[model samples]
Target: MVYYAYFQGKAPDVTKKRFKTVWDIPKEELLAPGHRMCQGCGAAIVFRHLLKAVGKDVVIVQATGCVEVTTTVFPETAWRVPYIHVAFENAASVASGIAAAIKALKRKGVLPPDKKVKVVATAGDGGTFDIGMQALSGMLERGDDVMYVVYDNEAYMNTGIQRSSATPWGAWTTTTPVGKRWRGEWRWKKDIVGIALAHRVPYIATANPAYPLDLIEKFRRAFETEGPSLVHVLSPCPPGWRIPPDKTIEVAKLATLTGMWVNLEIVEGQPRVTVKVPKRKPVKVYLKMQGRFRHLRDEDIAFIQKVVDAEVERINKWVGEEAIGPVVEE
Candidate 1:
């Protein structure tokens, strides 16, 4: 008697040896140069790495946000593949419609049935976790054959650095400013991944630009998955996060090392922590490095530490183990 699972032979191993540096990324560039992204834009890095992993046989639907605004400026467009720009709160919904059209076309022999084109929707925290939640939820609940990737910078970076639902606790934003009434963003970061998990999508994961290999691998898995896939990437914004341009990768690394952000994936309803942090660093090390957390008092920092510790504890409980976070060298 032979027993098996859907995980067996589901897809080929496309993760070519673990990637380490920027040079390890593919030479082919999908997003053309000469765009108006920031000096040390993490979103651009995420876009490039994801395109490298997903390849060119895809269609992209970009919601109105930083990436869309910066890349598509009227007469100038940076996208090299088939791309569409949608309203601020409807990228996923538009992508769903496109996917449905493709399926209908293929069935009617109007489009090549042998060729497969993946639908990918890109948005920021403001568009995804806030304004676009309804449409995004609809897409996920409907089980559309599309990938919704949210490049979470934790705030509305393009709109004067306002606070979005993805903003973490104790961080300062324009809206969640330090004042007599507000001590930075008092509310905790919204768990966008958890919301996606509730929909029980076929694939769900978290990625960070700091770990290029891991980020790229998650994209590959998302594209290969048949049903809806949600990938939440913690893209650090230089200005919004109040960090130096060059410290983008370093800051992002500290986030994972301090257990503030844990790399995870959900497959067949089984949760797994892909990156292992073994010995977690103190949250202060991660918070003190960012300017956004500069206003945090001793008590505030302690509060953040408690939040991080609780998050790490929760992840450990789910994985049924300890020290199970991304292995990034401190």
Candidate 2:
């Protein structure tokens, strides 16, 4: 899949040429450079990189959230392709409807028979894990030929940093503030990728913005999949995460290295570790870098570490082998 392409060395001629650059990624800007997104916004970078991979023959359906608010600021839009704005929880439904309509139009000869247009629905963690699950599930069950991408920043950052189901354990947010009553959000993060795999989507993968080639490759795969497909990206927010704006990519890289976030691909309900870590870094190396976890006591950090270790073990067991090496180039 394109999402896992960064891990692989072989590539098609086009991709090979693009990889000759310093970052081994394309330079074209489809999302434009002057958008209202915050400095070092991981989601914004994801959008830009995604468009560069797919080119101009795509339609985007965006749900109400940070990406929509910042990019489509009333009178202007940064998108160079066809873009549609939908309600917070209806992005999947809208994308499904658009995909179906395109088929109908082609059948009626209203459009060229050979024409191929891709439809992509995007949302944040709040929309995907909570408010939009019903609509998303419905679209997946119906086998809509649309790609769904969730730029998971782990909270409702647009709505004042409220804790969402995707928020990591022990992370601080407005509702999950650090105080005597609570050290941070105490619940486990929701597993949306696992839920999508259960729906039996043809393709599903997790990506990271730090690895641009892998991120764009996943976008290409999701668009090419025959049925509903999904790609979840670990988008880091500078202000919300209490990290330096320029450290977005660094933080994301640490997340995968520390085993806090695993990048995997699911095909026909089978999961493969795309970015394997032979010797995972300690979870504290990732945790202590962000202020959201600053309130965690030593025991709290230890508990988080144990959870990550168990997850890594589970993935290895599922694959029937230990990881051979790191997926991304160090």
Candidate 3:
């Protein structure tokens, strides 16, 4: 299907060879190193691979969050490509404006008619799930030719370990503290994929930095797909989650193995699991590694398991296959 609707005449070739492994990815680095991002930051890993997948012919619209602040101090920056730093609530809006300007420039013959520059908007959970919802919604509803990415670390890790709408149930944060009356955040994580699906955009997907190849492939799909696309990534935070720096990727993988996070892609409204798990580990196996859920009682863990079970079942039914099987006690 022709997805690039905003381009006049004809769109540039978006087709590219699929990545078979890490070695297949481009060697060029668009995001420079030596930034202020913490060690083992999942978002940092995400940006590295993401830039490699999309190549250098892209513009990044970054929201005011961890990635933006850390990567772009007053005098230095980690970005090598065209990058714009916007507010916490308007990354999508600014990206949409850029896309529109590109379309206009192509039509006016001011820029090369066949120039193919992809516009990508990136934000953390706080900017995406909470503050940027309105601007994001407008972008998707307008069917702007852009790809919006959310590197969700669950809470507002940049400002502080504050609870966001994306924070999971029974997880501790600065806002959702554990005490006599309150025990972490009591609400379940918001279904961001579902919300994007409602907009009927061309593409929607969930990715994890732990699965580098899968994450790269999904980014390719999002970049090639016509209209607006959203890729929600599960990013692990070491300081916020209270885990060691080296445990970032391990914890991210465990999230999928225990059904806490499902790796899937929805294209043109059809959903399918991109990375399948034949068998699942118990939820506690995933939770115990992080200090955020350490205060969770046995009953609390059981409740979380039930929630994961239901979500897994729902996704499997939608895909017409058991992508993630029932949890097995080991």
Best by TM-score: 3
Q: Give the TM-score of candidate 2.
A: 0.91
State the displacement of the C-alpha of residue 141, model 1, in Å, after optimal TM-score superposition: 0.8
Q: Could you give candidate 2's per-residue lDDT for residues 169-269 as a string of tens digits?
A: 99999999998889899999998987886676778889998877677877777777776889999999999999999999999999988888888877655
What is candidate 2's local distance difference test score?
Answer: 0.84
lDDT by residue for model 1 (38-78), tens = 98999999998888878899999988999999998989998
**Candidate 3 lDDT, 103-150, residue by residue in tens:** 999999988999989799999988989999999999988889889999
Candidate 1's C-alpha runs over 4 A off are 1-24, 325-330
**RMSD of candidate 3 to true structure, Å:** 2.8
Which one wins by lDDT: 2 or 3? 3
The lDDT for every candidate, in the order shown, is: 0.85, 0.84, 0.89
Residue 285, model 1: Cα distance from true site in angstroms: 1.2
Off by over 4 Å in 3: 1-17
What is the lDDT for 124 in model 2?
95
Candidate 1 local lDDT, residue 83: 91
Which residue pairs come into collision in candidate 1?
275-325, 275-326, 276-325, 276-326, 277-325
